[model samples]
Target: MIAIVDCNSFYVSCERLFKPHLNGKPVGVMSNNDGCVIALSNELKALGVKMGTPAHYLKEQVARGEITLFSSNYELYGDISTRVQAVLEEFSAGIDPYSIDECWVNFDGFAPGQLEDHARELRRQVKQYTGIPVSIGVAPTRTLAKVANRASKKIEGFGGVCVLYPDSPQTKGLLQRFELGDVWGVGRRLAEKLGNMGINTAWDLRNQNAKEIRRRFSVTLERTVLELQETPAIEMIGMDFARERIMTSRSFGRLTNDKGEIREAIRQHAQRSAEKLRKQGSLCRAVLVFLRTNPHRQDLAQHNPSMIIELNNPTDDSREIVAAAIQVLERLHAPNKRYMNGGVMLMDICERGTEQLSLLGTQQSDAERQRSEKLMGVMDELNQKMGRGTVRIGTPSAGAAWHLRCAHRSPRYTTRWEEIPPVRL
Candidate 1:
């Protein structure tokens, strides 16, 4: 059987893990740049603070003590997620971490009754270890397990675990109540098509002929529905090996008309992206740099220019990537234009060992590559031990007009010593 485990109010739970006083209080976590509300606690939801509502729009409510808001604290959340995943790893033979707060576990053994007990135990262990509550859904298929999980949230005494066995009467009732859109693979467009055909419920779609569904839709969609009707066909497994891509970007803290500042911003982004490339054991063959003016201010002159540069060789070396990024930045920069934001994107990534040699020119010597690797290694280690920007390129500081305005950001309570949040007795 496949079991889907999802953490409840994940961000709020993470905050409460360190600050217990927030327990049962209205809380919400903001999105990147603290622009909008992303995660809301039960209390916050009850207070009518909807998700995605901009922080600026909620100023009045916040002033009235209707809700507590927090900037996105990824460092704290990432640490807590790791703890939660570690607890999950102990229960199942294999686990597929779906996202920050969700995972799918393969429970190959144990009967129906045993599965229930296993689910309860998993929840208790995770909560005990991480102080985070989770809901578990067990079924023959992943889709049914998801539905069972959502249903479990409303029921009491389930201990956050719900199992839907195909042979049980509850399974049929659950299928009847589930909407097509609620199913895993059914998207809005497919759901609308199904609604038009009167296949509005999971039971309705399940009862349809697989051959007919295949003829109406594609083979893939038909297979998904058939799997949902019986048992989940997808296995809980690790992600497939594929090339990675890194896009690093940031907006200037203030708009500037200086060409030097624009170049500096792009160079900083490129350096950051190259650092990430080295960390991931990959090299880039191409880099893209772009600059843009503020889109919201329609009355202002807007100029968005971008350029892509091909590298002489595939390299994870920050120096090479930064050089190529600056070349593109030079071409895209406009004189006397106030640029609001700029970024660098590294692409055509390949493993360092598997990099193809140049056909027209001599390949880099082993000693040269080794020296470059060693330098990058030391740079990364120093940056991690200290803070980011501690060992940055000189160009990043040349025209430092573009910086983040994180005036109200909470300290890196878990990751950095100087930024740790203080606890009160």
Candidate 2:
């Protein structure tokens, strides 16, 4: 059997972990720059606060103090996510971390009759250890596990865990009740196409000829249909085989046309991206830098420019990546233009050892490679032991002008020592 465990209202739950007073209240989390709503608690959903609503539109709620808002605190979230994953490691041997708040567990050795009991215990232990509520779904295929997860919340008597078997009679009604658009792989366009064919549910899609569906749509859709019928063709791949792309960007607290400020932002982004590359043991051959003026400000002259630079040899060194970003920014940067945001992207990634050395003499020597690797490893270890930014590239000096404006951000309760919660006697 395959099982998927997903955290419930993850961002809101994260905030509630630090502030217990916010529980059972209408709470929402905003995106970068506090622009739009990205997460909504059940209470907020009940209050009709829709996801993606502009922050300015919620001024009335803010004034009334009916809704609690938080700026995205990624440092706290990432740390808590790591803790949650560690707790999950005790459950099953075959674990695939699907996302920050979700994972798949394969129950190869466990008895089938005790699966539900095991899932219930799993949920109890996670909440006991991490203070995060999770819902689990168990089924024969990964797709059905997702379905069972959704049903766990909506169906009565599930108690945070739902199991569905391919041969069970209940599976048919549940599949028919679920909308086609809600299926795992079906998108709006595909939903509309399927709707025209009078196939509007999982059961409808399952009844269609798999070969015909493949001919009409593609093999991917055919696989979805087969998966619905309880055939396990979709298996999780290992991390080594996974493709990855890392991008770090943020909107400024205030728009500035200063070249130095823009340079500082891109440099910070490059340094952070390089850190992630080294953690994954990957190297990138291309770096992309983008700069843009705020489109909402009508009085300002809008300029959005981006540039991509390809390196002769792939590297995970922060210095080389920052240099490449600055070179591109020099070409893309404009004078007297108020830039609202800028970012750096590391692309064309490959495993560090898998990268073939160029025969044309662009590759570094063995000694140089060893020194670079040692320097990066030490830097990463220091940052991990201390807090982030404890040791960073030298481009960002004291009191940098490009800091983010997080007026309502919560404390880094999990990551920082100074911000840890106080216990009352």
lDDT of each: 0.81, 0.87
Model 1, runs deviating above 4 Å: 235-240, 252-254, 258-264, 275-280, 359-364, 378-401, 405-407, 422-425
Best by lDDT: 2
Residue pairs in clash, model 2:
none
**Mind giving the per-residue lDDT tens digits that candidate 2 earns over 296-391?**
998999999988999978899888999999999999989889998899999999998899787765345766878988998999999999989888
Q: Candidate 2: global Cα-lDDT?
A: 0.87
- Candidate 2 — which residues are off by over 4 angstroms? 238-245, 310-312, 354-364, 395-401
- Cα lDDT tens digits, model 1, 303-374, are 998888898778888888888888887787778678888888888999878988867653556668789989
Candidate 2 residue 311 Cα shift, in angstroms, is 3.5
Candidate 1 clashes between residue pairs 3 or more apart in a chain or in different chains:
141-232
**Which candidate should be chosen as best, given TM-score against the real structure?**
2
